[model samples]
Target: MHGLVNRCIEVFLRSTYGNALWQEVAAETDVHPDGFLTWGNSPDGVTRSIVIASARRLDKSAGELLEDVGAWLSRQEQIRRLLRFGGASFEEFVESLRELPGRVKLVIPDLELPGFAVLSDARGRYRIIAESHQSGLMRVMAGMLRGMADDYGSLVIISVARDRIEIDVVLPDYSGRRRFELSPMQVRP
Candidate 1:
């Protein structure tokens, strides 16, 4: 597994729970207390162990915990900026998901992101099929979709299954959206 993925989990644990909880999780998983390097690689077993131990200590299901991690990730400025680059509206963003893996690869050549296949039904409902070696990726994607919906000021109902996610956009533009600029320097204080 890529270190970035594990590092995200570590950051999520530390920021959401606390450094102490993260330390306990690291010790329980036999991982180094300093956590993963952003550009390094670790065995997939290490990632699984950390998730399992963290979930057990936190008294939450792994899926639930991973989902929270996804939400936390979306709130990060760098990640949010990357996701916001998908589109201006939620619907457009959903449509752009097919290119997400490639986009991410362009930035991090060695990072292994999940492949997303976006499908739409006659009723305008969208389904995202996530393919990855890691488990619970779909759940994380569900959390990210929910967070992005909020960022786009849209109302959506999202459901997660083992390998796919369903999204029902109730209102594409339900409220005011956060400002986004093509260049950070364009922002005014």
Candidate 2:
């Protein structure tokens, strides 16, 4: 890889997503496409086309990794992090997400929930369908029941569906599923 093309992509990304978001995406995926501002053939046979080829290779494992997840509650935790998020509040959560880069529609039932659960980084929003090779969707139905305490009122998660999770009450929907890490202590931003 030549510094020239790399610089080109850097410029484009800095301008588009802004330094903050672009840098975050770059950190996670390790690809900086800012040079895509122009299409230049590399001196070697390996041109900008190399990026596309590599992406294809990456697609194989990444595709199946998310699909093989079998737990219904895990899926719900995934969705919870995506839709409203599991951090301090729903708003701070969505502000940090990169959108689902592809189109994959998984079935999600709108239902009541018990409490909040944590979501995972993989398969949260990157794939098309949340495929389960085993059984557990019913467990989600039961876990949601756990949120039903006699005297507490708060957003409790009941089940998981991919990056979306169900809570006791409906939250105003945010656009894309953003990944979040939960901590015991709140850090000042």
Candidate 3:
């Protein structure tokens, strides 16, 4: 995993639960308290351990904890800045999500990131297909999308299916007019 992801997790735990809890969790999880190097990489097990330990400590499901982490990540200035590099508007940002792995590669050449695909439904909504070797990451994606909706001041409904995830973004004014038109995008490795 990239150090950026680890750093975000550290920040999320510290901000949401406080430094004391983070210290305790880190100690229990056997994660380093010294912090992750932003440009470096860590074992994937390290992230999994932190997530599992956090879930146990908070008495929450791992998926739920990850959702909160994703929500918190969406609010971080560092994440916002990195995301904003793709676009200025919510629609653009969502559209640009498919290119995230490539973008990450530019910053961390050896890191492996997940893949995304955007498909337009006949009902005028967008379905995002998240492909990853790891399980439960899509739950985090759902929360991140919800947080992004809040960030953009847009109302959105997100649903997850067996193999694909769908997001229906409601435009402003609540009036049944001018639905967003998202161009279909597919970026595969």
Candidate 4:
């Protein structure tokens, strides 16, 4: 896993809990307490262990922590830049999610990022299938999608199927009629 993922977990812990608690979790989980450069990599198991240990310390479910971490990541400037590069609108960005891991590869060629397959099932609804050789990472994808929706000032309801690692994205008014446009594009006749 990329150090960016671990760094985010560390940041989430420090922000949500505290520096001391982060230290405790890192010690208990056997994760390094420092030196997590975003461009570096770590064993996927270590990252997962840190997250699980953090949840136990905070008395929250792993899913809740993952979702909060995803949301917090969206708020980070580095990740915001990447998501902005994906598209200008919530719908467009979500549609381009499948390409994110590929883009991540540009920076870390050997990184094994999670893969996504986004498909439009019907109007206002989409399905995203996320797969990773490592388990439990799909929860992060589900939360990331939710965070992306928040970034666009949009509301989305997400349902996850853990067995298949599929996330169903439902937009209540995704008919494009309520879309917030900055300005109308001009057409030449």
User: What TM-score would each prediction reach against the true structure?
Assistant: 0.94, 0.18, 0.79, 0.79
Q: Write the per-residue lDDT of candidate 4 for residues 81-155, one digit (tens) a residue.
A: 667678776778777877888887897787767676778867557777655443356667667777777666666
Give candidate 4's whole-model lDDT: 0.70
Candidate 3 lDDT score relative to the true structure: 0.72
lDDT of 1 by residue, 36-119 (tens): 866688898898889889999989999998898888888998799889999988999989989988998898999978686899
| Clash tally for model 3 | 0
Q: Give lDDT for model 2.
A: 0.33
Clashing pairs in 3: none
TM-score of 3: 0.79
Writing each residue's lDDT as its tens digit, candidate 2 over 18-128 gives 676545545454555343343443442232333333334345332222222222222344443344332344323322222321111222222212232333443221111
Residue 109 displacement (Å), model 2: 58
Which regions in candidate 1 have their CA more than 4 angstroms from the true location? Answer: 132-135
On lDDT, the stronger of 3 and 4 is 3
Clash pairs (backbone) in predicted model 4: none
Ranking by lDDT: 1, 3, 4, 2
Identify the candidate with maximal lDDT.
1
Q: Give the Cα lDDT of each candidate.
A: 0.87, 0.33, 0.72, 0.70
| Displacement of the residue 57 alpha carbon in candidate 1, Å | 1.5
